[model samples]
Target: MVNNKTCPGCGVMLPNKNLEFSDQYNASGECIQLYHELSANFIMSPDVTFRTQHAVDAYGAQHSGNRVKNIRTAFSLIGLYLAVEREYTGRQVQHAHMELAKRNIKWSSFILPIRPYALSVADVLNIVEVKRNEMLMEWSKNVWDTWENYHEWTRNICKSYLKHF
Candidate 1:
């Protein structure tokens, strides 16, 4: 029950699959580790969330890159979220002004810089938030103006088809 928490819908190990049916064991342990961290702490715990080299070797080399990419995506999102908090919340979350030094960006370390940037994480966060808000607003407006009037579109399509017929 503690270590082997399988999906409610399936009876396989949480991280292992019963390959006869793909959906039979879909809730992965690695996935749940990240999910619980985000749900409980609202922050990414990079150390705890990914597969080891042994696990990757045991599973398949083909999936190794995907596992690392997923871990990196979590880290990037946390960085972006911290930047957003710095933009709007200001000292509310720890590491608000923090950013990766140019050399350290390639290493993906969480170390505070020896000489931090004047440009600041908050500026990056604010830009990200603004861009995200702009895209979301545009998408919502497009959906409202286009897809929400699906009945009218269908009617027009039918009318145009009848005219051709």
Candidate 2:
């Protein structure tokens, strides 16, 4: 039997065979596997657009640590902010990401929480199919809430760069 590996970031355990994985973001092979499972739910759903966007932001933000690039982390947090605060749909957040990418907005580095996520893709996956979407949003919100230190910065950046979107 294969041994299980634990993700240092979110504390999820997955079966491991010592395969190569990204340590920069604390994404173990198991963590990526869990993410893939989460993605499959959205990918196979009729409401793919909204759920996909949320999964992207939620997973991205939850996984981002000091080892993650500032730009990518900023994108993740901004996406979360727009989705949760502004009630932007997944499509709108995607457009906002594109718009922000075009501008010269300076993305600031965040001092992410030591444990960036309390909930993992596994948590969402465990919920009943009918309530999965709600659980996904809850996961997103929980991840976003952990990055509370950067809320003002995220808000200001969106306010300045994404006002028209």
Q: What is the C-alpha lDDT of each candidate?
A: 0.27, 0.80
Predicted candidate 1 versus true structure: per-residue lDDT over 45-136, tens digit per residue: 23232212111111211111222443232233332232222232212212211332211333232211132113211122234533633332
Question: What value does the lDDT take at residue 36 in candidate 2?
Answer: 83
* Candidate number achieving the greatest TM-score relative to the actual structure: 2
True-vs-predicted CA distance for residue 110, candidate 2, Å: 2.2
- What candidate 1 gets wrong by more than 4 Å, as runs, is 1-12, 15-34, 41-67, 70-97, 101-104, 108-165
Q: Can you tell me which runs of candidate 2 are displaced by over 4 Å? A: none
lDDT of 1: 0.27
Model 2 alpha-carbon miss at residue 32, Å: 0.6
Per-candidate TM equals 0.18, 0.88
